[model samples]
Target: MSRSFIIDGSIIYTNYSQIIGQSKFEELLREFVDILKEKQSPLLNALNAFKVNSDYDVHRFTEYLHLLTMRNIKEIGNIIYYVNPKDLERFIEAFYTFWRSKHRFMVRNEKYAEDYNRRASIEYTVTMIGDQFKATIKNLYRELMMNVSNTFPTVMRQLPSGAQVMFLIQEPNGEKYRKNEWVTKIPTVWGAIFDPPAIFYTKSNKRRGILPVVEKDILSEIALDPNEWYRFAIYVGDLLMYNFVHVEYLAHGAGLANLFELATPKDLESREPDGILIFGLPADKIPGYNEKWRNGVIFKEEDGYTGVIPAFDENDYFGYMKKTTLTIHNLIKIDRGKLPIHGSMARITLKSGKSVVAMFVGDSGAGKSETLDALNRLEEVAQIDTIIDDMGSLDIIDGHVVAFGTETGAFVRLDDLPPGFAYSTMDRSIFMNPDQINARVIVPFNNYNEVITPTHIDFFLYANNYTEVHNDEERIVFFKNPNEALKVFSEGKRMSKGTTSETGLTNSYFANPFGAIQRKEEHHRIAEHFIKKMFETGVKIGEIRTMLGVQGYEKEGTMLAARALLKVIEQI
Candidate 1:
């Protein structure tokens, strides 16, 4: 009546007649009995080898046999046609393979042993202690002193609109630091932590940059320290719209504070943070840092707020820091049912004094910023004001679609810009890993009001940076149908320009993963409503192929795209 089995130390019972028909159940039982009589000794040996302590493992084996029998009966003639000595041996081997694959501890242990041996084989030898050695030791001591100074509590006492930020250091031997989950998973490397890299960009010379890690993994990897001393409070955005980030860990707090506007401790204590970011412990401390899912960055949407946790070191701080802000903004925007587009937006005033606000939606390295920056420099476009450089939101305001910027500063790629542009903003810019190909700079180029204020959008365009256009007419294609326009906008298609790990051509829905991807239904509803309204209001919709992403055609493609954009503007 009832069949019982053990799996992973747990007992599971099933009613054979209820699960499989009575006839099939009897047929399987008969087959299993015959097999036991013939191969009982070998099967028992195999079970013992697998450490099967209970009867459930046997039942599980019978279940597998039943399924296999059923499959053979349906495919071939009858149960007698398939169940034999040869097939039974094959089945046993297949089951062993499946079990071994699932139980991978043995494999992992061997891998760990290999890695330990490899690391142990490396040699580090010291020669005679000459003048050079003495000087090297002295330089090391000086560098240690500099790190000590830089490791002190960094406080930003004042921020615009009464926001402040502070980074308090945690004691090395504190109970909170030692007892955290992340600490337990990963061993702490104090020397590596104390002497972190000065730059955060990737070292790759290729045009495509490092791929961004998933946000959820980054958040889940964090293990918060109980001590409040390791915490920091910062205010970001502006008074009209702003959010507070109460983060744990000095490096993450410092990285974020440097990237965005800071807020005061008092403001954070009084106001609920729009998002919370926790950097639990360093990546080196995590046990399985090399695993695919454990890249140490994660984001989660909670009740009334969003949260982000990133496991990043000093060398990758710039990229992760930017991601933290973008992730938070995206979560908030999606929660509020607003569309957050990954692109650059600007308000351009033509020579005729007609001002039009446009949003160039695309992934990174899609020429969104470059095209906007080039247009800003053109004499025909006399005045150009940036709303947001990286990420922003689109919403309906006063019955008209309006665009709002998210940050006061722009985190721009150095390789994309013309020579001398980075130097011009050096006074206000924070350059990161300048020697690397995908180096970055954060500069306060746009006003806070310009970033936060809602500007009426007159044009919506996709920056087609990688597509090949045969003629000038093909460079820009206007969408006459709203469905066609929505399709293009939703597809978010573009060629990879090495800003991320993706190669060749890739596409994202709405060219936005943060906001649009999170709330698909809401994004669709908002986008459809906006697109229909734009058509009715005479707002232009089209694509501009900059060809900046293509190799060997970067300059020529950009020029051609720019000229085409200029022509489109002239008609407007």
Candidate 2:
């Protein structure tokens, strides 16, 4: 308490005057004032979060003055910090003086000491944030090696354009680098980074149980924590829902907002939500359901809305946040007579203006993304615009099976990508556990308008990542009929590439475990209808042998399959 700063977990908040002087805040305001007068950017707009006296000519710096005192400031590592620019001699001195002493206290903890003994996985800072922030702001990052542990979380999490967080520099300064601004959040950091005993997430043990009809409100009896409740209204292909997430898992939950369209306030206010998903809640918070799911998630139809709750964070993986959100989306699709697909889709165009909308359906590690990436690289393929990267839905519109995309971004495996692929989009990507196997990069590739628009399927092909086709023509084999297509698709088989918990050969119903597997009966009825509609509508159905999971094939197999696809599209 004598330190004049409130320390909660990894976050610290104190009076502005404690670290930064009044002159620094004013100097900061002047720079942003200049930027607003000359240029505009999504980042520069963080200042716009503060209201302006619209009628005033050169109104006093009253807003900035109030900000200097007002609490609830926020920080995103050095990428975005609230006050006291990282390079300011004051900040460097203040932080070093404080954490240096605290390090002694923290090292006293046996577990902290043990973990510190292990390598800190410094590679994250090297590739992702080391060059990212320090190079941009003031270029003093590497010199500040001691701060890596606390800085990593803030730099890696990408915020949506208008999140309450603000951009520094467009607003503040550290003498010569006086153009820097820092975001500061005033609220208490409650349960923000508490590492509870969580299950290691593996695809194998995570079971799914669906309750067709739940008669009562499961949450009615428990006392819910209000501060922990945060809402993310996202559109998974227009199936809009309010996802209420627990603050502990909120960062990962917010990842869903990055991929899917975060529903606008206008829509959220006007339209009724199609579903309500509550993620990261303790089983005790929802008493009635724990008896059913000892470890896995529970998908149930409650009062006309679908719900999915992952009872535990066993694996501490991003997949929990992603898959649970998809499950809610898919279940809603199942109820609305649509088929939720776990696959990749794109719109490829040739030089002659000929366009083909191709869909490669498969489970995780079946080359849904890798094959499509390879397809984009083909010389003859003039342009390939991705429509859906991971999850999508098939609906019968005007008696044809039309597909709608569920995500604008992709949660792509680093190893599956072609050389220099992930780095190509480094600026827009967020890397998760980069030093470990099954590392991934979450990058927003397409816009919401592109993915949400209903597009007809030109080719509905199953991704055969396991098989190698030597002959060009043999790379893509057409299904004899709808039954054959249904048989191959429903019996979703693929060689696991260690991207998931499963190893070697595996089978998932329809290559989709999200909601399709949870509500198989309903999904089957819907799948049959859509596949039949595809055949009736003359949508080319077949299997593209990517050979991505096949030994010695890898990138070559995908390129070969892509070549075959180009020829097939031209022939069609």
Candidate 3:
């Protein structure tokens, strides 16, 4: 029994002999169909058995089908009886051309339509969701994932230091986390996903490392929504930093929003962001975590963009918030080529009616803020206006050294602050882990205007609280040469007082890793040039040994530093 087959809606078979008066091309087609039928059943069964599951499988199957069809035609041409070779050849060529063209068209059209529909559906969904939650509470992730525009709903604000920032958020797909369980892996772009770090109650405790991101995995990580997240535009020194982040809870975002003076949608309309920081935090422990995530925070710089992703954990009261903010600041520092110093700054007025803007550079527990707070309490000091307490920028503008504040609020260590300080700002502050040793509060200590304005730096001093001063009158050592000033600034040496995991003496480039370390050569050049310029302008450069890093000398050091600072202000 001969098999039957259909070709272009015509029935053909090996045994059927209706060849009389039929065109040679028709005869050829009948032969081809008969041969195809002989092999079709096995091919169909094989294809069915190897079901098209993934895109790769579908592609392989399509290629196999095309090859099989062409082979069958050729086989039939050789076996057909009484068929003219020239006629057969022409028919084969025409059929091949048609098949190829049809296949190409179908593949191209299908892919194009699929992409277009997917995009359109996302846009339509975004519009619907945005409209639904316009006035009420809404999940930003939902709105963004469905959004048609590449740009998300953004917010911008001017930092205290006159830098404007914009935040761009990428929303993750809703089903991504649901499908993977709530414990989805932290996106690789935002540092390595790892188990919790070893907690040490001892001094000199090494914090967890931050892993560099695998650049190739960034997009995939961004698309996965492990949890709800928020993006922030906070002014860090001279750059406007954008932070795309997910915290374990909404309260963290709310707290930071209040602390950073987050801009509204209306504010974003007028400003452009300077740099970006993409970060992700998982609520629960990540299962089967990548080993790279345990390495630590990763800093990436590409074309006009700079960013970092720190390792994240929900209960990490220190590194999670602290390191993430530092990463963002460092990114901005790299982007803007500004000097980010770990310090406190203020505009002080002396009893003699002399006003000077002074910056006290130091590490944590080095009494930078405490010294300034003490200066504010001095009777000889007329008024002391706080500019920035944690991090700030130093820039050379028009041949004059100037300082700018980063945050409007201060993330001060509660243990070091005056007894009533945290309580005084409780209404507008967010206290994190108050029961812990390194308890922190974000309070709006200064207005936005006070932070952004470029203030001429009249004095630059290192808050050397670790150094013991036997002679209190000779506590302040003035540098005669700019090189000497640069040496001290570059050393950034300070004693650890348990504000962080570091114990004993430690040093960072200019007491800052955020800006100075990222751009060492640039910062050094700027420092040299600015120091000389400041010296020529008669701006005082010196180090004041407050000894505040010592246990029993906190009050004594503050008093001595305040009195010396008052004298310096009077002279200026």
Candidate 4:
């Protein structure tokens, strides 16, 4: 039997035709165009296909397409034969029987229902794909939150513009995608190019991927909110100490490097963005919080990291921020060769709220050490002890002044020290070669000396003129100009000039009560009175420590000395 077939969409043409080629579906359109140009159809060549055009053909095509849409394999034909018959009833019955037998297996195939639901139309496939994209973006946001959980609740106050800062990241993604993909590089690049903020505060929330805590939160938490001072103090101290020590901003981990974007108040107000995070805090809460952070600067690494971090329950972020400012001071080499060996004199004000004899200057080999030696033995001198032999630091603390003396008290008994330590201690001195001195030519020099009291006269003289008291009258002068005062010393010969004595030829200025005692008396009065003048100036103990290179202590000592000096100034 040569069975008839219908092609509803387009005729399988050996030559191109109008509506059939144009109106066909895309795949079918291409097939029709190719077949028409070649004058042969791929379908016809492969399966011996033919086309029929009529209402009956159209009806048949529609019926077949519907079965195919349902994935009814048996209903589809492996071979369709062309037919011409005048007895239409007999032909129709035979055709229907053939169709029913061909589709029998398709009806029993379990996938028929499944194929109908899935391949019903193109719209269903597109809707499924859209849902998948949404889910991916949602997950990416979650991952960002998880990474930033560690530095959450970060706060800052009084931040300057254009300060580079960082956020903290705890859990980073280990996915196949690059970190940039997750962070959204395009937006980050735009932020950097247009506006950069001081720093970022971020933390990984366990449930989320990463969370960004930006400039607004920093300001409100620290600058605007009163309760958040402790948090503010922590970050501020980190900022200040980092700035002070490094003189530059510190970069945290790599991801944090890009994430920090701080904005200024002006940026925020204009809707331009002042900072990244903005908390709505009141104005009154600002000052106190700011002050707390300022004070937190005094805390050490341990205090800042351990005590403060735990206090706020923010150990992760706080632990990483550096807390102390580092300052290095270099000491000048002491000239051992120079004498009336150069004696240094600085005003020392004691904590006892009293000013006493402290200054000493001396001529080379003149017993400067001996005078100090004498004072060291005195109970009074022992009370207002020396803080440093040569150097120290001074810092302010709570309006009080304190000192760190590098050297042990001059009275330290060498015998009491361990043998190893005693060897290094500067407790003993050697004096020799007195006559080898160049006596005829004097190397004149000038220096400012610290004389706290008239009692300092003995020490200064002892330090200056030990072996020989030159005829130079060592007396205090009321004349303001020091050069002119020294000029008077240059011009003079002694009154009550010395005659030969049993010991040696005596210059009366060296021993005569009139010259020696008179000058001593004058210097004593000046020493006692001059200290009162110095009291008007602040002197500190920490200054003593830094000067002397005291062991294992500088920061604390500096603060104490500074405070002490201020107090003294106030009292004076």
On lDDT, the candidate that comes out on top is: 2
lDDT of 2 by residue, 34-81 (tens): 544465433333334333653212233334323323322232323333
State the weakest 10-residue window (summed lDDT) of model 4.
103-112
User: By lDDT, highest first, what's the ranking?
Assistant: 2, 1, 3, 4
TM-score, one value per model: 0.58, 0.66, 0.59, 0.17
Off by over 4 Å in 3: 1-221, 224-227, 247-249, 267-272, 282-296, 304-315
Off by over 4 Å in 1: 1-255, 280-293, 296-317
Q: Please give the CA lDDT of all the candidate structures.
A: 0.53, 0.58, 0.52, 0.22
* Each prediction's RMSD to truth: 22.4, 17.3, 23.4, 35.9
Candidate number of the best TM-score: 2
- Candidate 4 to truth, TM: 0.17
Q: Let me know the TM-score candidate 1 reaches against the reference structure.
A: 0.58
> Can you rank all candidates by TM-score, best first?
2, 3, 1, 4
271-296: candidate 3 lDDT, tens digit per residue: 55555554444412332245555423
Candidate 2 structure, TM-score to reference: 0.66
lDDT of 4 by residue, 1-572 (tens): 11111122112222112212333222332333343337542222212123443112333433332333333223344433322222222322333233222101000001111244543432233233323322332332222222222122244232121112211111212222231231111111001111122122322100101111111222212321111110111111001111110101111111111221222112222231100111112324332343233212121121121111111212122112211111101000011110111222333334455554333322122222223333333333223344222222222234332222111112122221223432332222111111221111101011112111111211111121212221212211122333332332222212210111112222222121111222334433433333322332332111111111122321222233223333433355
Better of 1 and 4 by TM-score: 1
